[model samples]
Target: MHIEDHPVLGKQLQAPVKFYFNGQEYKAYKQQTVAAALIANGIKKFGLSRKLVQSRGLFCSRGRCCSCYMTVNGEDHVRTCMTRIDEGMIVSPNLEDPVIRSDRDGD
Candidate 1:
């Protein structure tokens, strides 16, 4: 779903790069963010809500919203919208419990 040519911006000139998401391979251009790549690949659901367990996707493309949080490499809570796609970079959905734990109760 990538825009091959923008009326104002013209054609994309960046070279394509490969990255993995949820063990699946996808292509993206250099300097493109992970969220952008995922969206381009038709991936709308990024994570789920804690309380209601509702499906969450890219709400704010900016880094302000936490809706786009995902796991990258071995790190959790990585903002996909702010993370640039790198060659061979591994990305996965955040599988950890989304519940906010209280410090008083140790899980």
Candidate 2:
């Protein structure tokens, strides 16, 4: 859930923007970052660790940590905490494989 009324910022008044996460549609404020929107939507786990395969979530929230990495619009390894939300943007959990292979690779 978002902060409707911050002690200093007061009531947050922003336009709603629609985006997709894991094939599901979610709404977020225009000024909110992708990570903030996901948390507000009740999504805690952003992706899995490459080695341990453990769940990864928001940490640091300052774009300094890799814990909030997610795939955005076919781009992998995106820092959700630093990326601003955009309408129609597609976000998904990062895959274990850092390299994304396409059928064209013929692997």
- Model 1 lDDT tens row, 1-107: 88888889998747899999888999988878989999999998888777787888788889998899988886778899999888998988865664456554585
Best model per lDDT: 2
* lDDT agreement of model 1 with the native: 0.84
Backbone atom clashes (below 3 Å) for every candidate = 0, 0
Q: Tell me the TM-score of each prediction against the true structure.
A: 0.85, 0.87
lDDT digits (tens) for residues 20-97 of candidate 2:
999999989888989999999999999988888899989998989878999999888999999999999999998577
Residue 73, candidate 1: how far off, in angstroms?
Answer: 1.0
Worst 10 residues of 1 by lDDT: 96-105
Which TM-score value belongs to model 2? 0.87
Best candidate, TM-score-wise?
Answer: 2
Off by over 4 Å in 1: 98-107
